[model samples]
Target: MSRTTPATLALDRAGVAYELATYDYDPKAERVGLQAADALGAPPGEVLKTLMVKVDGRPACVVLASDREVSMKKLAAALGGKSAEMMKPADAERLTGYRVGGVSPFGQKRAVPTIVDAPAAALPQAYVNGGQRGLQVRLAPADLVRLAGAQVAPVT
Candidate 1:
């Protein structure tokens, strides 16, 4: 399958090293990240999930391990905000210019503050959405942090 998405293009432009892979996307799965981890033969910790959230009513991007859950309290503290919550699917799609399951932190429509969980940062490599359903981009965690200007924090 062609992997030339906005996310890929952004990586290309940045000259960052990355790889792409695809899997059978299960829309019916309870958690898309878990399904992706299982399908990719990767540990859940190596598969990162990109979540669109609002911190004090403003949008932000959060990257963390699929096996972990973001603590809203920690998220707020990390971003220096008073409160945080998941953005509505439609709002997230609109803000990021990607469908819910396909949202990638690499090439959002508008750049927002980003945070990479400490767990993901500790990984040598990690996988995140490739701006499309069933597609994943694998790269060094350091590259992700650099490319996204993401603050590393213990949000999970």
Candidate 2:
């Protein structure tokens, strides 16, 4: 467990409680979220990945299950945009203040609109990147929603 990261601090400011989980990180892993789920010994569906996307050229955050893919059409519609695409890794990092493999929905450099796929709320608790690679935070779905100021939609 490490000290407070911006993500954790955001949770603190929101009066949200969470537990931290850390594991050995392998840069070679193709899917960061899958790797984290495996390390945390949780089902892939219980772990969410924070994705940076451009909806009509505006940056936004989308979170979904580790095992699922975000549907661009659905995400765009959710954001009232015509189209959406994944953000470039460099741009995503710069905008979110986190590395490619460790983007979190909270504590961003700027307040970006966030959408959390509805499926994530099905789980009792969810694991998400803790603003750093190899670190994760577990919290109730309601807390996550509140902390991220996220809208829930069927975007996965």
**Top-TM-score candidate index:** 1
lDDT of each: 0.94, 0.90
Encode model 1's per-residue lDDT on 1-156: one tens digit a residue.
Answer: 568888999999999999999999999999999999999999999999999999999999999999999999899999999999999999999999999999999889999999999979988888989999999999999999999999999998
Q: TM-score for candidate 1, please give it.
A: 0.98
TM-score for each predicted model, relative to the true structure:
0.98, 0.96
lDDT of 2 by residue, 47-91 (tens): 999999999999999999999999999999999999999999999
Model 1: colliding residue pairs: none
Per-prediction CA RMSD (Å):
0.7, 1.0
Error of 2 at 29 (Å): 0.8
